[model samples]
Target: MIVFLAALLMILGLIGRMVYLMVFDAEYYQKKAEDLHERERKIKAARGEIVDTNGTVLATNRTVCTISVIHSQIKEPEVVIKKLSKCLGMEEAEVRKRVEKVSSMERIKTNVDKETGDKIREMELAGVKVDEDFKRYYPYNELASKVIGFTGGDNQGIIGLEVRYEDYLKGSNGRILTTTDARGIELEGVAEDRVEPVAGKTLQISMDYNIQMYAQQMAEKVMEEKQADKVAILLMNPQNGEILAMVNVPEFDLNEPFTLNQDQEISEKSKEALNQMWRNGCINDTYEPGSTFKIITASACLEERVVSLSDTFSCPGYRIVEDRKIRCHKVGGHGAETFVQGIQNSCNPVFIDIGLRLGTGRFCDYFEQFGLLGKTGVDLPGEAATIMHKEENIGQVELATMSFGQSFQVTPIQMAATVSALINGGKRVTPHFGVRILDKDKETVRELKYDDGKHIVSEETSRTMQALLESVVSEGSGKNAKIEGYHIGGKTATSQTLPRSANKYISSFIGFAPAGNPQILGMCVIYNPQGVYYGGTIAAPVIRDIFDNIFPYLGIEKDVEMQYTN
Candidate 1:
C-alpha cells in the first residue's frame, strides 16, 4: 500500500512540474536564455559584387564597423556614452538610452567609417564593441543606379538588379559569443565561439560599362533638350537577346537612392515623388508605340502573304473605316506607292488596308505570335504584361487604328525584344541581363540559359522587312538616325496619348545596324515632350548619338564600302 501510494504521488508531482514549466516558468526561462546564451555579436556577411561584362565593378563592398553596447559588460557607462556620442554623431541622451537597455546588448550605430571607428577604439571604453562589417558602395555614384540598385541597413537588397537577384547576392551572416568578466570586459580566450559567414557569389552581367555610360549621356542630353517628363533607352545584341545598355535618365545615386532630382516645383510631395523616381520606365510604362509599331504590321502582312512588295496603295490622307475616318500622319497622303514604299513612309492608310485584308482573327493571331500580347520575359522584376485587345471584340475602327500602332499599349522592353526578333532572322528571344553566375574566386559556375526563341516570321519575310526598315533611314523619315559608315535600318514612331483625350505624345525610334546581318539593335523613348514630338526629329538623333560611341567601342568596324564621314 505504501509503495503504490509513493508511485502515485511521484506521477502527480511530474504533472505539476510540467504544468509549471508550460504556464508559469516558460517566460522566465526564455528571459534567462536571452540574458545569457542569446547575447551574441552578429558578423555581417559581405554582399556579392555586381560586375559589368568587362569585369569592372559596378557594385562592391567596403569595410565598415558596427558599434554596440552590452549593458552587463559596460563598466564606466558615462565615459562610454560621452566618447561614443561624439564619434557616432548620436546625442549623449540617445547613447545613454541604448546603454541602459535591459536587453543583453544594444546597437549604438552601424556602418561607422574607419576614421571614426579608430577614434572610438583609441578611447578603449569598456563594454563597447567595434566589430568589422561591410557597406554596399557604388563606385560610379549615379551611373546605372536603377540597374544595380541599393541595399538596406541589414544589407538586404531593396531595388533594381539588387532586389532581383537578392538570393544570390545576400550571403549568410555569422555570429560570435563571448562571456563577460567581472569588470564587464570580454575575458580573453574564455567561452568564445564563432560561426564564420560565407560571402555571396558574384553576378556577371552582359552590360558593358562603357556602353551603359554613353547611353545614359545621350538620354540625359535628350531629356534636357526636349524637357520631357522622362526618357527610356535600351540597346541589345539582336542575335542573342543580350541587353547591352539600358538607361532611364534622371537616375538617382545608389549611394543616396532616396533623394529626388526633377524640375517638379512641389516642395512637399515626398513619398509619392520618391517612388516615382525609382520606377524603371523601360519595362513598367506603356505607350501606343505610335508609327514605330509599323514594324509589327509590316511583318504580319508579309508573313500572312496578304501583301506583296509590288502591291500599290493610294492614300488620300484618310481612310473611311465604317462611319469614322482615320487620317495618316502625312495629311496629303502617299499617292500610288509600292508596299515596300508604304512601309518606308510609315503610311497609316496603306497599313489599315493591309489590316482589313488580313481580317481581325488573323491579325490578332499574328500579334500574339509576335509576343505582343504578353511580357518580354526579361530577367528583371515588375515586367508588365501587354495591354491588348480581346480576340472576340475586334471592330473595323479598332483594326484601322491598330494597323498604324494605335489602340495598343506595349512596354519599351516588349517593343525592343519584338523588334530584335524582326531583324534577327525572326527568332523571338527572351531578353536577359545576367550572363553567368561566378564564385568569389571569379570562377564561372552557371551559364545563363535562354529560350531558343521560336520563329515568328519566315527568314525571307525577315529579310524583306529589314530592307524596308533600312530604306526608312536611307530615304525616308529616319534620315537623322544615319551614323557615318554603318548601314542602319530604322523606323520612327510618334504616338498620341489617350485618357481618351490628352494631347500628349510619346516619341520613339527603333533601329538595327549593319542591315545585311544585324548584330546590334536599339530603341529610345521620350515621354511627353513640350514642342516637337516627332520620333524622326527627336528620338532618332539620340539613337545616332549612342551608335557613334557604341559602334567603335564594340569594334563593329566601319564599312569600307559605305563610309560616310561624320
Candidate 2:
C-alpha cells in the first residue's frame, strides 16, 4: 500500500513539471519548428543595359531556362543517365558519373537552348526542374567589339566598358522565403516572405552605329591590304570630344568571348593571338607623335609669341642642338622659307627652330598645357599616358627632337585630343565614349556627358593653325588625304620606336574634316608593318577611306566631282 502511494506521488510530480514546461516554452518551440520547415527562394534582379545615343541596343539580357536534376528522386541511376544523356546530347558515361556522385542533390546542366528546354519539360522526367535566368547577348556581334566589350561566365563584366562600369551595370538583387514540399516545389497559397528586386540603370553611349561600321570596314580592309600586324581607327567629334567610332583589328566576336578571355591555362598560341586582339591599341599603345606633333609645336610657338607666321628660317637638311643633329624631311634642305610654308611642307628643321625659339622652359610648359605628358582620361579601359623622359630640365636636343615628335611616346587618344584643340577654337576637350545610362523600361537614367574644355590658346592662333594644316592636305605630304569639297586638315607621322632596341616603327595619321567648321576628327595607326611604313603611305590612305565611307552618312555634301564620279 505504501509503495503504491509513493508511485502515485512521483507520477503526479512528473505531470506537474510537464505542465509547467508546456506553459512557459510553448511559443518558442512552435516558432522553431515552423522555421525548420520553411522554404528559401531567390528573386533575380535585372541587369543594366548598354545602348547607343539614339536608343539602339548594343548589349542586353535575355531570359533562358536552366535545367537541374534531383538525384535522390531519380529511381534508376543507370537508366536515368542513359535517358538524360540522350536528351542532353551528352556522353552516357558523363551523365552516369554525375548521377552517381550526387544522387540526392540538384545537378545543373551547362545550358539549355529553347528546343532542349521544351523537350525536357515535355518529357517531365522525374526529378527534372527548370528555372529562369538572364544571359547577356550582343546583337551586333563582332561590330564595335573592342569598344563595347563583353562579360564572363558569372554574368560579370571582365573587360572594356563593361568591366569599367560594373557597379552601375549590376543592379540590386532580391530574396524571398517560403514553404516547399520534399520535391522543392513551392507550397500552394503560401504568402511567405519576399524582397522586391531593383533593376539596374541603362547606359547610353556616344557611338554611332553607322559611323562605327564604316570605320570598321575600312580598318579591316586596310589591315588586310597592308598585311599589317595591328591597326586601330578612331573617329571623334572635335567640337565636344565625342567619340563616334573606335575599332581595332583583328576584331573579336562578342558571341564567342570565351576563348578570348582565357587565362594562361589556354594554349600559348591562343594566348598570343588573344593578347593582340585585346589591346584596344588606340588608347592603350603609345607611339612617337612624329610630325603630327609639329602642330603642337607650332601652336605653342604661336601662343608664346616665340615665332610668327611670317618668320622665315633657312633649312639646311638638319639642325644642330647641343651637338645632336635633327634632320629635316628634305635630305638636302628646304632652303629659306616662311613659317607658313615650313608648316605646309612639315619641314622638320623649321619645327626644330620653333622649339628652340620656345626654349626648354616654355616648351615643357606648353607640352603639359597641350594635354601631353598625361592621360586624356577617356571613358574607355586601359588608357596609357604620354611617356616623356625625365627631362624637367629639357635640353636643346630634347626640345628640338620633341618639336618634331621624337624622344617621347603618346597614346593615340591623347594625340587626337590635342589635335582636336588645335582646330576646335583652341579648347582642350576631354574625350569620352558613353553618352548616358538608361533602364529596362526605356527611361533615361543618365544624360549625355561632356568634358569641360578649357581655352588653351587664342582663337586667332587656332584659326591660323587650321589654315596651315588645311594647306598640308591640299598641297603637301597629306595630299592623298584630301576629299575635294570638304576642307580637311591633317598631319602625317612616322615615329621611330623609342627604346631604340626594338627597331620598331609606328606609322600614324591624324586629321579633321570640313576644316572650316570641323565635324569629325580621325586617326589611323599601323604598328610595326613589313615595308613602306611611313605615315603618308600607311596612315593617310586610311583617313581617306574613313572619310569616303562616313561622309555621306553624316549628311556631308559631296564634292561636285565626287558626285559625278559616283
Candidate 1 lDDT, tens digit per residue, 441-557? 899988989896799988888888788888889889999998877789999999889875888999999998887678889899999888999999999999988888778778787
C-alpha RMSD values across all candidates: 4.4, 5.9
> What TM-score does each of the candidates earn?
0.92, 0.86
lDDT of 2 by residue, 1-566 (tens): 99999999999999988887688877887776666556444555667888876778889887666666666556666667777788888888877777777533455574467577777778767666665556788998988888888877557887788887788887887766767565545467988688877877887788988888878888888778778877888899988888999888888888787574343478878868776676688888887878898888999999889898789999999988877787887899989999988987789989888888888877878888887877888988789888886767567888888889888888888989999988888888888987777667777766756667678788888887788888888888888898867778898988777567987788888888777668899999887777787888779988987897788888777443211100
> Which candidate tops TM-score?
1
Q: How many times do residue backbones clash in model 2? A: 7
Q: Clashes in model 2: which pairs? A: 71-103, 72-103, 72-104, 202-437, 202-438, 203-437, 204-436
Residue 473, candidate 1: Cα error in Å is 0.8
TM-score of 1: 0.92
Clashing pairs in 1: 292-493
Alpha-carbon deviation at 22 in model 1, angstroms: 14
Which 10-residue window of candidate 1 scores lowest in summed lDDT?
A: 557-566
